[model samples]
Target: MTSRVLIAVTHLLGVGHLARAAALARGLAAAGNEVTLISGGAPAPLVAMDGVRLVQLPPVHIVGTAFSALLGSDGAPAGDTIMEERRRLMMEAVAGLRPDVVITELFPFGRRVLADEFLALAGAARALVPRAAILSSVRDVLVVPSKPGRLEEAHARLLALYDGVLVHGDAAVLPLERSWPVAAEIAPLLHYTGYIDDRPVTPAGEGADGAGEIVVSGGGSAASLPLFRAALGAARSVAGHRWRLLVGRGVPEEAFAALAGEAPAHMTVERARADFPALLARAALSVSQAGYNTVIDIVRARVRAVVVPFEAGRETEQRLRAESLAEAGVWPFAVVPEAGLSAQALAQAVTQTLARPLPPGAAIDRDGVAASVALVACFAQARCRRFPALSRALDEVAAGGGSVALWWRDDDAVAPTPALDRLLSLAAKHALPVAIAAIPAHATQALADRLAGEPLASVLVHGLSHANHAPEGEKKAEFGPHRPLAALCKDAAEGLRRAGETFGAPLLPVFVPPWNRVSDDLAAQLAACGFAGLSAAGKATRPDARRARGLAIAHTHIDPIDWHGGGGLLPLAEIDDRAALAVRARAAAGGEIVLGLLTHHLAQDEATWAFCDDLLAFLLDHPAVVRADARRLFREAGEEEAWCAA
Candidate 1:
């Protein structure tokens, strides 16, 4: 259950992306997973990195709002050398860790400039022996691209390479569709994980350092320099109030010193504080840009605030967030547009915000860190629900110079239906063979024609008429003991004859009993009736006696349908438990054991179909599991001579 997770995040302007990724890494690590966070941004001293493996690449950041151009650590254009080093380090981490899950933060959504490295990392993940689940991590809101086809390109890349996208905000509060144009196209893969607020809550009056003071912050970047300068001028005008300005580290030393020097006697300007959230707890009013993390802190503090969103260089993420929250009345704030922001406007907004009473705390989801951690963990495991256990067992078998054989069987096939098409498509998709049990009385030539095109599909006779012959008090079965021996044997021979006539070349000489139940006398006569093999549910019983009578047994061990309970698909955990037990038993027996997956195509719902598709693809992709078709399985079961003769 302990998965190894690798999170890749790069921040070009602000540290919000890195900060969110770090929080996620910590949450996963706390859940007993091995977490490695690779950051490709300028390091921020305030971001927590406890209980995580931190990998820093040659960092590159953009100056001001010039996102098209990247600057190296020396503040010059990032040349080929730095970009190459970054890509090399990224691929190295992916190769070295061989993670079970790879989370690319904001790629294929907002980081088109760094597509080369992200695409390469995704390719490496796909090439792993057991492929890693690739996921995209994005904030609640995004900057909608104005250029033609950019959104389409992101959508295409997501469909091609990603398994899921974690939207870190609650849909009820703010859905991705509010900002993303193609949200509907990728809706199936989006998981809304509340909001990622990991800051510890501090009680009111606890923040003595900022009690009754005006707090101003611009997040952890120099992009907030305009906001700081505006707030400085506003502080001089707004008298009789203690003011605190927190300058981010990304601001140049001279810029920070200038703000501090120009502060009035009532104001204090310093570097961004680690306890900003704590400061907000007691501050009378908060003045800051409407970044995701900042808004979360303000919401937790329940403080009346003024928001000056950073809208430079066509940046609309913060502006959209501020407007949405304000419109919903979720957080008490007044927005001061950055276009015409000045000392007078900021002072008026700050005074108005302080005048309003604190709005009652809105009931919104704020458990996003924990929710995201649980979601990612489940996403990683669910990508291959039963595969890890089966893979491990197969690994041990291979280590001991053994191997595993797997076969697929779907019952209740009468004619060519959409369900049958889906089953056949799954088989062809993985190039794995499937044994379809068709009722001979109802089997049609159309079904045979369909199978002719699908070489991997073969037909097995599923009883004479698939009509229950058992007494009403007992379980339903077609070939139960209530029937006479001669009558049952005659029906068996007739069923095989009908199946052979219907499906000439694709027919396998196998008997599949309805409800997997047949009388002992009837089972004993299958080989004599030219069955060559008996297919049933559960493990093969009386193998020696059947083999002496020249009848091979290939029993299906896994069934995903809950026929006895509601007739819907069983929970994935139950199916995985069954599979784990089967695989472990096979490994312990120390031989090439064939594990069969049983399904009912006609009875399958969307959930069942999806599960079967994933299961089949996983078994086919595994290196140690051999896909055994019906003919091959029966031949391996000591019916080679019978198959050859037929």
Candidate 2:
């Protein structure tokens, strides 16, 4: 189960992206996987490369915030020749490694200038014999695109090419939706891996180097020159305490020399330290720009701090992270906006931040390295099992010049809950349609509103009220013979009408009985109530007879939950056995059978959810399995014949 993984990362102005990619490579390599990390930016001496195969392309970077102008290592505009060379090197690495998974860091989302190379890498990965699972690696918050159609372009690229996006932060802390506008459309593919922090925890009293000094730093970029100058000016005003300023590596040598010379007697300025986290552990207070790696270090150190986020060039990412974290009150902190930063404002913020009481410990999830590794492994395992026994059976059908159709249905949807969201997310993720049997009496407008964005979901009318009228010692049934024929027919018609009003075009004129049971008398009356189809559990009984009576019947063949065994997931082996039987039955029946997979989201646990996700992925990957859309399956009365004939 050791997968070959290739991670491609390019740092334009800061080294945060490359730093995170390096952490992931180390974690994956430590877990016994063959990991190759390809860097497209200037090499950094601080990033660790232990246990990873490193490939460096001709480095390209941007000066200041001029992202439109790409500069080479020689500080000149990178011409067409250099760009072609970079693409060639990247393609060569991808073709040679033949990795099982390809991870692109912040491409499609941030690096629009390099789309050609990243797109080529994705195409090359897909062209491999066993196509690699392509994923986008991104930070918690992205720089919101202001240009028209930029968001649309990125979203389109993701839907067309990527398998999933690994978000390296917790959703509860800072959900990507707060920054990315189209997050809901791609919610199914987002996997939050917590915050990626590999720094060792320094205990109290362990960092004597910065024991009682006010430590100030900008991340590994020159984006904080103004902040450093303001800090120098603030040192004289904020005064009884000693000040220590750490300049980033991207700062010019002359700039560093000037800052060092201008320092007062109580102030010290130096290059960014390798042991900054240790320094923060014992520092009196931390004052720095709000960047991913910097915030993580501050949070890990449990130090009182003031964050002055870099807001130049309309960059809102740092400001958003700083404000959100301050609002979360995870720890005592202050946010000083960089727009009008000066010595007085920074001095006041720093002094006030020092007066606040420190929290006992951090509340954020910091196991990102392990969590990211596990997520990648899970994705790889799922990909390997994409052609399971059921899929193989369909392959045989395809080899014999035939194909099999499959559809999904979930029952008892009444409202929009977390479980329902998960169910719809799975459908969206696999690009498959799912027919939701909604209890009309309890269905809410909120549920209808939620489905407005999900074009792949359709609704079917469950029995009115979903209430049982059967007598004691009898099986539960809502549309059973216990009620008058007129009453049953009226309820069926009313249910269809209510569902139509709520769901509009997404509503299918189908009747689903409660507990998957309906009396023969009521079944005969469904066509009269304007229902084009009748769906229940197991095989359709007397299908030809039903079609002759102006009704098409489609029944779900497999349910992966153990309803009688404590409502947990049925063993995968048992599910696989049942699926094999279903496929065999479909093949024996002239390949006209549409294999139906049933689920009840309300009753599903984590194990059941995982099984369903895997099942859908398996079905989608098989070349011979055609996913039948519910609308097409039951578009008209007696349409089953036309569908079966095809």
Candidate 3:
């Protein structure tokens, strides 16, 4: 069935809100949904909402950050006539379409002025034959209301009208609670869909024309004149790199013309270019406002940026975003707050940003449009079957004060294969860290060199040799009781030493026995062999789970592979049941133990890969979960114990 969606958006000052909503509308349409976008704000110059039924209401705009006076299209202060007309048209659209989903952009939180229109629209949609799913679409940062009872009012409306809240930002970067005071009250309804990037970016290239140039920009330019002026002043002192300022279209043409005329001979000033993402890719440094669209563009371009936020009046949104974006680690961004925004400060920020290396493309979830549409569809259908079960499982784990930890144990890694490359690619896709269990005797120098370069990859000793030295009619065992105790210890010690020598610091001295069958006596010899941890399948039988020969004993709870059943992935139900049980165990244990996932890349089939892909994606997206390699797990354990002792 084709789902119909209605989106309501009103941008009073800047065009970012409309742009974001339009992008989502277009995305829903592309996903085979009939979409109608009702825009109440004035027509923006370049904003496009194609492929959707566009309905324009009486234009209204706010005068400055005061948001006190609403101006109409005729440039006169709007009265009840414009407000009543806007509400009427909005209501008419909702009543006509009776959409399956209703999305209101920034209502009740940031756009209190449009409460009448949105509230009425929500009420009408709810009264339809089939109640429409209502979603409150909000950006990462919201303007905290100063007036008393504002938050309570927003909370009340959300509790009453909205089915869910779609937060278009990565929670790891900026969660809803940073600026909004009622985050806890509405926690159950909020879903972070990562940052939305509407513009396509060109990959970073070498020796492009704009390389080594300082590129600066203001997102909409209404509040960016100061930043542009300060950038020009800073350019004069920074003599090494070429400086180019792309003034935004939101600045009055006369203002831009005046600034362009006063540009230094060494600097270039022009209106914002369509190739801004490409420009950032080639440029050595980026200077811009901390708007949502511009920040995502900078991150996509993977350039070092200095963000000078626009903080006019009581607007603290950009300032908060600047600081949080820098802290997010998706990219390198320096913040020059309005309090310290000057020629000297801009120059210093530019110099500092340039001193650092350009950051790599972020591994964040940038598929916000698709995720949002899925969420809307799920809520509309009143079914949880539309999305991944793993996602729901993660939400539960996060809500329960527990976390999921995943690690890969690829056995018999003598050299890299196309399959190994594919496995690592999947790991990178989910930003999941891996602990490669290398057979020390069979591990090649080339494999060690490759693992050395991967920042997220760590080396672990699989065994002295993968060869089984068991007696006749016995099961395969390398580090098992079948081997002599002294000889086995020597072999383990040699494997640890060789791995450390080959991979250097990247090698985490963790022993992963072949067949997951290490003898109890041999397990005690790990730390004496310089191993910091031992990872194996199944629960530990040791009474004291911590501090085994100065090593942490972490065992895998789920091995999706059905080893006895042709080495394919086990049934999803079985894997999930095992994982859930392990998570419950950890929660009962006060969240102290790490939940591990064991995998052998060499033995994986197509089904195995798919299971891993879905499973890891969910775990990495979870807020409470922390991805760690064997090295990080042991280090964190040591730190926690030290803290307890202190």
Cα-lDDT of candidate 3: 0.76
* Candidate 1 lDDT by residue in tens digits, 435-553: 99999999889988888878888889999899988888899988888989999999999999999999998888999998988777887678889988888875422111113257777
- TM-score versus the correct structure, for each prediction: 0.65, 0.65, 0.58
User: Candidate 2 versus the native: TM-score?
Assistant: 0.65
Candidate 3 runs further than 4 Å off: 183-185, 205-211, 360-362, 383-646
List the lowest-lDDT window of 10 residues for candidate 3. 637-646
Off by over 4 Å in 2: 384-646
Writing each residue's lDDT as its tens digit, candidate 3 over 1-646 gives 5798999999887778888999899888988899999998877656667789999999887655758678897879888998899889988898788898999999878688777778889878865644677789999899877889888778767755666799998887688788886555368678898777766768777788677799988876367888888988899889899988887666889999888888888789887776778898888888988888888888788888889877888778887887776666676678888888899999998988788765663477677988888887887665222123444555677787777666556666779888878878867766677788888888888888877778778888888878888888888888889877898899899898887777787787788888778877777777787888877775522211534556776667768788777776565556666676666555555545467777788888765675565566446545767876766676655422211000
Model 2, span 1-646: residue lDDT tens: 8999999999988788899999999999999999999999988888998899999999998978898899999999999999999999888898888998999999889899899999999878866645678889999899867899898779767755677899999888888888887555467678899999987998858447788899999987888898999999889898888899999788889999999999998999999888888889989999998889988899999888888988888899888987787677665568889887998999999888888788775488778889999988977766534225665667778798877678899999989999999898778777789999999999999988887778889899998889988999898888877989999999999999999998888888988888888877777778889988878876422222224246676778779888778887665556666776777766776636577889999998755675676567667667777888888777634433422210
lDDT for every model?
0.82, 0.82, 0.76
